[model samples]
Target: MGDEWRAGGFGLYIHWPFCEAKCPYCDFNSHVRDAIDEPRWRAAL
Candidate 1:
């Protein structure tokens, strides 16, 4: 088990919660938006 994660087992994720449309099978916490506050969102990230 030692150093197991070093073998390409880790990932980096950035969750942007806004989308133009919602897909039927996506299990993400997201929203459908016609517009977004981009500057505010960038600052939050």
Candidate 2:
């Protein structure tokens, strides 16, 4: 248990639900549109 990588058990994970490309394998949660209305989406959220 003397691994240098394991000395500090600190990690970070970020989840961004937005995608610019539409993947066939992915659900409709992500979209790839030419224009995105940030103000509308922000207000809806």
**Candidate maximizing lDDT:** 1
User: Candidate 1's residue-wise lDDT over 1-45, tens digit each?
Assistant: 567669977677999989889989989999998889989989988
Error of 1 at 28 (Å): 0.4
The residue pairs in collision within model 2 are: none
List the candidates' TM-scores in order: 0.69, 0.41
Best by TM-score: 1
Q: Relative to the true structure, how large is the alpha-carbon lDDT of every model?
A: 0.89, 0.66
